[model samples]
Target: QQQVKQSPQSLIVQKGGIPIINCAYENTAFDYFPWYQQFPGKGPALLIAIRPDVSEKKEGRFTISFNKSAKQFSLHIMDSQPGDSATYFCAASIVGYQKVTFGIGTKLQVIP
Candidate 1:
């Protein structure tokens, strides 16, 4: 099972609010978990990532909470801003060059 599902198709948050998106995977073979951020017409960039060995990971304003047993994960954005408005995608990949499976994507709009 090499499938990852994400929810909340879209989200809106006021400035300084925290927006959260959730994702779940069924492939236990997946060892690398990465969240990607994409602006309009831009390539997805790695925002923050967490390995199976860690329960959570954070980078600056972005945070990733993971649950291995439940095969679930979520991304948290702190101090939401209009500039933070973008599409976020959760992805999973194997050790090698295996294609990274991506979530349908969540559109986040931060109101000023």
Candidate 2:
């Protein structure tokens, strides 16, 4: 139950493209879910996130959704621009246990 599966190893979109990245987990103890965005030579930064109790969340141009029963979640980018192109990762962790699990990753390229 410590593993998280992610989809679409890579994605290519236009300047105004909308891309979606999905992930699934099996552990129910995970209380925190976060989406991270990483550039070519930088560390991953927190994009948007949602808790198990939350159905969805939005921040700036990013959105995240979580399904408690389905054990799934996803990240969506609206009005994607070239700056949005990066490697995205979905992660899960127990609030107080300090245990975190991360998905493989999705490499996104936004063409101008």
Candidate 3:
């Protein structure tokens, strides 16, 4: 069953703009949240991740904000550029578990 949900099927932003993608999970057991970024004809790569213990995490231009009580999380892209344009997915899983539930996906376009 699908436990994670994401909003805004697609988004467009100008260069240097910030784009946000939101996600929510239904299972409280989910303790790990990760966001993946994929470019055309390539496998998805782990952009950033957060545990319930941390409210937020940042890596380079990517950041993840997590809400443990609400079972929600979001990804924020800072200084988004054309190269950053890609399909992003939010996923949740239990710690030490291989099964991951992923959101539908959000396509972002950074226009010059």
C-alpha local distance difference test of each model: 0.92, 0.90, 0.92
Q: Give the TM-score of candidate 3.
A: 0.96
For candidate 1, the TM-score is 0.95
What's the lDDT for residue 87 in model 3?
96
Expressed as tens digits, the lDDT of each residue in 6-41 for candidate 2 is 998899999888999999998888889998899998
Instruction: Write one digit per residue (lDDT tens) for candidate 3, span 1-112.
Output: 6699997789999999999999999999988888999999999998889989999899998999988888789999999999999999999999988899899999999999
lDDT of 1 by residue, 15-76 (tens): 99999999999889999989999999999888998899999888898999999999999999
Local error of candidate 2 at 82, Å? 0.5
> How many residue pairs clash (N, CA or C atoms closer than 3 angstroms) in each of the candidate models, in the order given?
0, 0, 0
Candidate 3 RMSD to the correct structure: 0.8
The deviation in Å at residue 31 for candidate 2 is 1.2
Residue 99: error of model 3 in Å?
0.5
Q: Identify the runs in model 3 with alpha carbons over 4 angstroms from their true place.
A: none
Q: TM-score of model 2 relative to the true fold?
A: 0.95
